[model samples]
Target: MPIKSLLILISLLLFTQNIAAKEYKWSNKLTFLGFLKKHGIPQKTYYKMHKEDKELIQEIRAGQSYSINRKKGKITTINIPVSDELMLQLKNSKKGYTYKYVEIPYDLIERTISIKMKYGFKKDLYRATKTWYYGKELEEVYSKSIPFNKMRKGDRIILFYTQRYRNNKPYTSPQIDACLIEIKGKPFYGFLMDNEKYYDSLGRQYKRTYTTRFIRPVPNMKRISSRFTHRRYHPIHKRYRPHLGIDYAARSGSRIVASSKGKVVFKGWKGGYGRTIEIQHANGLKTLYAHMRGYAKGVNRGTYVGQGKTIGYVGTSGRSTGPHLHFGLYKKGRAINPARYVSKPSAKTIKLKGKAYNKLRKLVRHYRPQFRETRARKNSIIKKESKKCLNCFKKLPPRKK
Candidate 1:
């Protein structure tokens, strides 16, 4: 009787496994082609990808997690995130293996993490949360203005951030909205603005001394078909989605020029992007032009091109619904709004003023009340060893202008 029961338990476990999606970590040494081959996916499935789509597979980093659902040990579906907003999905049917780029479905979770310095900011943060992602970001925001060497014991630290979650776990690093650091007894505050820059209580920026302004790739902007956003309700899918790049609606065969001086890194068909070109410019900047008709002569990979030089022609390509160009700008592998970088090159530090500064003031006001509440708490009452936060961010109703 005991032996029969054990066999039944093993069978039940196997049956449950077949219906559930199993998660796996991507190996560093495994190329995208190698991954397909190892899983019995046909080599042609990889070779047939648009050269641009082929380049996108490189964005899959080692240790990145993916999911697979199988039946009888045969893959039925697979989802692998290739970029922050896009995923590579593979489905197996009776005919063959098929793949496409889809939006990576995730939830946005807003949180606040508070800690007191015991073993330094990074170490103490890791101790409380089991992660150390916000250290570099905090340093980048305050390193120039604050003296890190002066941090003393019990220096309070608080951050209000939002992160993307998949499978109920963190999918990416926290995007800090506001941060407060106490040096000695005085408090320093940093608030995030829509421009993706952090400013102090007075709307001053202290990180970089100079800013490199960028130009629009397409000449004569008729209109923007789609704008960049971190979150929005999709009209077709009825889901909250993020668009990392902007789309410019233009006529077919219109001239597309290089946004700035840079060397051509890639020029080929990308999955949904259709015909695409990527250029590597100075200051760790990279620009992308997609959904084009054709490339300019001699603008191959590794060729240096200057700003305003013709690089490609616009057309409907990839998974486009119409004749529009998808333009993307990235800094160190992170997508940022190209709209902010245009026509604002300056040699001196850029400070928030006028309407931009007023917008930042609103953001600061939203976060100030929380700071006041936190200031009342005694350091002895704070959970120095535990990974807990003070309170989540709250938005007050906007006042009439």
Candidate 2:
């Protein structure tokens, strides 16, 4: 072929290749359902995808981007990023549209964060670490001892955690390995332990106990709306009466677990206490759960429930004003304060002598420096910002003529 004809042919081939591999970006302004409709995806295809993967029904948030791959104006594939580390993909093939849930690989990064609280401990932790989910996990780790709501300004916290990243950008919140909260200048340290439990610096488990006599009924709830008191004005009855149980304030439908391994003595409605369940444990201890929405499947009378087994969910069944679990404890058929029984552990510290103690000490030392440096840098930035604001204020002319 002549040179001129060959050049024209090459140009045409390049253009065709570009058209065949074209890409387009789309944002989800409405729900995923609306997006599917807008994209002209058939209802049958959508239903099939939904049936295969229930997560397909999850609504794509506004401003989230999805990429489309087209070959000569016909879409060949679509990729929707459900999260930083997970992508939901649909591809057009000879067999029809195929759905695939792909996990994007992430780099694990270890980080240390130390901050002095100006607001809530949770809020400060999130601000310092840029991890919103860390608050819930940290709260759960420290809920047994630390009164997070009662934390005051200037309380300091140091944490060692791991975060997932893709291309140096964070993908998920930090998973705390160890943390230390200084409340009133007294440091309380929590370290991750076996079975994903938290233990104190002295090696005592936070939520778990050495002895199985007592465990937390509701693991996630941290706030106690009402405690066992001699006499208090009843919210429903509007009269002074002796309150036997402690009311743990949690969202409705929150899991309520068995405090210790026990037999379900009663699992039916009690007149005053709505949707109540009673369990008779070893050592003549009986626990009662009231104001439950419903019982878990197969959790009936005479069912042998293990410790931490979810038996019911929080609800306002009978004599309750809001969603809370009314937890009661009885010893040998005599009513007792659940708080005393729940908080008072048989052992305070797990003995970690010799090699175990040495290993833990080394780990703490390795992570402590990173947190200190981060805290120092943050303090320096705050000081500089404050000084700059003061200078700007001074440079301003005196109040208008």
Candidate 3:
């Protein structure tokens, strides 16, 4: 199990008579209204909230624990995490009750670890780091290129990674920026690039592009007219606004495809999004294609479509000024940057070229010195651990005298 899950499960809840703080796990079948009613909160709270905020209620998942604090037997504060980066905060005071979306504050911790395979990779990693996640991460980042199962005792694993922490407790999984796994005395390395793809010291990639769950709706856009933003001042409205999606510059009649296979939950005009289609995909992800000129035939609510299936066309609808597609991706109920999720990968392994490749090489160079100091241990790592690998030794036949 990841350390994050362990912490959440084992963490204690503090409570008192005059002042009390308690935690409760969200039930799988619980609805937002159900939660409100159970907690003695007014159901009017949901009906009064903004449309998007109302939708965010769907972000809360089953088994997720939330906190509630009370003073003098009355609720004082409540905090429920809706997403990894955002939470729903409710406050009750003499002024009355109120709730709003707030950003989740977490400290980013960067670390470097080197682990020697004393017992086994999985066992040692858990003993040293309390996580089998890194082991799987290494296996994935070096998939097809390196066989981690082939590693013998004494084989070392080094990683430069970062993780997020909230209230001194880990939540998200650690992200490894660079890794090295010594197998049979040969050093195999992987470096994470800005694009989130992994490459080796020689700039060779083993990941298949199409293997990603999500792909760009507009395959060959000329350029992104506007990128995702948290908040900005609207020129026309003269108010703070947020473009929670990417705007792809294309002709009005250009095709828009499904980012992944999913069932369409909505297909219609969505306020400022204009004509839109929302698809519910696996893992609680929903992709929105807005400002569409037209929807494809037979495409409607409850329609299931495959990845890359044409669903609509580009257009300047709603508040849009020009012909383009506004693409938004949401996980649970929070908007997320699509750059990491959307890809236009080909079938073969991707190799950086020209400036991109040059930049990658520079990054590799920066990481070289950091890991080069451990290269001296490479040869010693491949030695046989006969004590553990007893089968590795040839059976001694009875000598005939």
Candidate 4:
């Protein structure tokens, strides 16, 4: 009886040990995403941060433990490390997403930029944040939303893109990105879950083209000031002051055309710049006319001038510069070389330039060869069809009356 009792006690102990040893292990067998949902954590936050990373999408292994730490109902951290050439690190619930939008400035040194939001984070990703670029006053740039999906680890972006001028001047601005993540097994590089957030934030089109104004800028015309003799070293100053403005050689009092259509912001003497006119063009562009013998009739400050219209004439009035028209081009408030904007003066010139750049030569060469090949193929097909019809003795029926 005692032996029987001992055997029963051992059996009970073994049963208890078996139940207790059932280890709770998570696997890559279940979707790493599915596990998060089953555990009752938010998937939206995770999805927002890594949606754009194609490599990360490929490396997710089922049955692999996704190390995460939670506080209350929110995910504080996620560490599923993958290794690749581009080092990508993901961080959960770091700081709220932030951004500032800025408009192009007016002046030549600095542009007129406006901010939408100050630096702050919202609880929800749907909220918009704004900021501005201030040269003198605010210019109203748009706000940006937190990119939940496109916001990946090690992701970077620019708030504003500096436009190129004819002279190819360089401008500097800040580039910002999210912090890097460190997962255990492999380092998933270039992973941004929903990073397309900032780019798509303003609902602004990714692709852009000029459509509103009819008058576009021209490019590559000879400037008389760029002549070699004018570049001679000054004797008194004992230093070389390269000619600042480009001179277009023309007859005295010739019809000086407006480079682009814009309101005349200033039309008067600008120091040594004699009888000058400045026209404000669209998209932060401006043009200057200097050394004019006389102003064009009906041309004045605040007047809307059309492109190619006679705004003034040539003269050597300001500082003995020369009898050439001094032309200037300004973009984002900075002076650029004028040669970049000289397009054709008429439709005929435009067509000629297009023909030079287009496939007219290649098309001419290919036309005869392509026509011959097509004719041969057509003849072969006709011969085959005729032979087949004759063999079948398929004749056309009489047309109905």
Candidate 5:
């Protein structure tokens, strides 16, 4: 009885295999000689193709696969293969005119991946393989393990994915088994085959690339005015005043913050820039805050302000302007646009916080002391990696405005 059952199972498997391997059938009949007469495929093409591949013409029979090129409603050429002996016979026979095989185009698909960044971090589902370019050949590139965070905005990345075509048509579903993110600063890259192995665009692969960088929070963050441009003739003045600062048009009394850990070098009134405050940051870089309504209590000429600490409120105290904060940056005593240095907070800030907070809340609801160990582990990892950041690269001295 066991032997009989095994035999039945093996037969069923073989039947299934045969069904899967079945060749596709043409939905309708297509002409070979008629197609050639209409397409004007040169006789040399068939002769050359058959001479090199003798079995090509003979093997092409009714219901067999072949390509036809048509112009208007006429067939100009036909290609058929003949075996070596048959080829000679056909050449000699008066009934056989001349024949040639034209090159048949093979289908190829190109896939594009777009990683959208919001203030330089992953915010939404990074799009993969949204558009495809179809051609006879596909361009592909790959790089060995590369760090992700090293990639900056507008950096070009050539990712790789595998595809197969059948009967000169692209398969609707593609196997996107891997991708390679290449950038000049990245350290490593590799394929992500299985779901378990896949990482987000800025996952652990980028952690090391962003070393020594901490989240520099903007205190009472406000919108920025005046984008950096070469032809920046002043918006208000109309004449070129060499706009050194990025205007943040905010309501009066909006808080102004220290960009980094720094000490106030110059405070109080200065020519043209009414209530100006200059904070000399570490490494010889300085941040100048102009047009302040009032200064924070205890923030004076020598006061030390921590990174992101509010030091004053936005106001129009300078050179006759409406309520706004004229934020300026000077390094090595030359002005540069402050807009280039600032970025909005990333989605990771909210996502990481949400994950930890939700987990903690769940533990609290259950009143489980066992969850304490999980919390401790999470905190330990955060503490170890907290100080390491992506922006810790030494600042280059500012260029003249």
Candidate 6:
């Protein structure tokens, strides 16, 4: 071929590439619906896309970029990224624009991290894992058996986790596959049995049985603003009175869960309790949640709710100073301390035997050696640090205590 002909062919290829690479950005002030209008997308086509894929409308956000391919000054194709793993593509055809959802593949990467606590468990866990969310995951896994707040100075933790990655960048939060926490030389192991549940080495579920009568109504809340007592100063009443229930300080709209599986005997407004929900469980055990902003949708009187279902949202509905959940526990018809029920371990535990227990044991053994080594190293470091601190203190001028 002649040199002139080759140059003309290269110019044509470059021009085609530029046309295909035309990209547009959605403005921050415009909603997704308005964005389509600004871009000349027809209302009928937008409605058709929404009818076919509701998520396309639900997941759109401002400032997102989309590619637009034009043919003779008419847009032919639009590709919008819905999420890291999903894309919404619309193409112009004789019939109009047609939409299709495209899924992007990602790699699931397994990771292991071991760390000794110099600070709190959350801080140390975050430092070792380099992920902020792993601390919460660890706490949730061990909340049933371990007290994370009570973990001592020399406690060590080993976590085997998995995360999804796209192009070697994290695309999802880390999930705990298995974890071992050693508090004061005692090891507690938690293995992921399934989605939303964990088990011990013996294949016992971390959650209590329904027959246990009571579980934590709000396991995620760490602080109790008020405790059940015969006499206490009322925050609003300005007088001494009996506080019938415990007040769990939580953010407004935070989920208030049912303590046990039972029927919703009452779910409506109460005088000072604001929005109240009461569940009647087996064996005459009853639990109450008060000071809720509103009841969870579909949760009403006569409805049976599961142990961990969201019953209401935290709020200062009536006669309350701030947002908090007033939790009450009852036996037969008498009010009791809700803390007692949660502080005590469940009397009944699901014991796995034979093949089931062995399977869990094998899975735990895979991480045991790693945990042991990590714990040993942590102890050595703590010992050295302690000695160094003692020497430094001795060298300083003594002050009156």
Clashes of 6: 0
The C-alpha stretches of model 5 lying farther than 4 A from their native spots are 1-218, 229-231, 234-239, 344-401
RMSD of each: 7.9, 19.8, 14.5, 30.1, 28.9, 19.8
lDDT by residue (88-201, candidate 2, tens digit) is 677887777777555555666555566778888778866765767677677667655576666677777776666665658765445577777877767777776431446676
Clashing pairs in 6: none
TM-score of each: 0.60, 0.41, 0.56, 0.33, 0.34, 0.48
What Cα-based lDDT does every candidate model obtain?
0.74, 0.65, 0.73, 0.40, 0.43, 0.67
* lDDT sort, best first: 1, 3, 6, 2, 5, 4
Model 5 — which ten-residue stretch has the worst lDDT? 134-143
Q: How close is candidate 1 to the true structure, as a TM-score?
A: 0.60
lDDT of 2 at 361: 66
Which residue pairs collide in model 1, if any? Answer: 52-269, 52-270, 53-270, 53-271
Index of the highest-TM-score prediction: 1
Model 4: per-residue Cα lDDT over 1-401, one tens digit each: 69999999999877665433212245635554565577565666444542223212323333333344444435444444221111123344457321111111111121111111222111111122122332111101111112223333322211212222212443222111111111221211111111111112112211211122323221223345452121224455332223433577666767777877899998886535667888999978878777688898999889998877878777766545346776766655445445434422222211222433233233224233422343333111211111111011113233223
lDDT of 1: 0.74
2 versus 6: better lDDT goes to? 6
Clashing pairs in 2: none
Cα deviation of 116, candidate 1, in Å: 10
Which window of 10 residues has the lowest lDDT sum in candidate 1? 384-393
Tens-digit per-residue lDDT, 299-327, candidate 1: 99999999999999988877547777888
In Å, residue 175's CA in model 3 sits off its true spot by 1.5
* lDDT for position 11 in model 2: 96
Q: In model 4, which regions exceed 4 Å deviation?
A: 1-223, 227-242, 343-401
What TM-score, to 2 decimals, does candidate 6 have? 0.48
Best-to-worst ranking by TM-score: 1, 3, 6, 2, 5, 4
In model 3, residue pairs whose N, Cα or C atoms come closer than 3 Å (at least 3 residues apart or on different chains), thus clashing, are none
Give me the runs in candidate 6 sitting further than 4 Å from their true place.
Answer: 1-16, 19-29, 49-52, 62-85, 92-95, 126-132, 193-195, 208-401
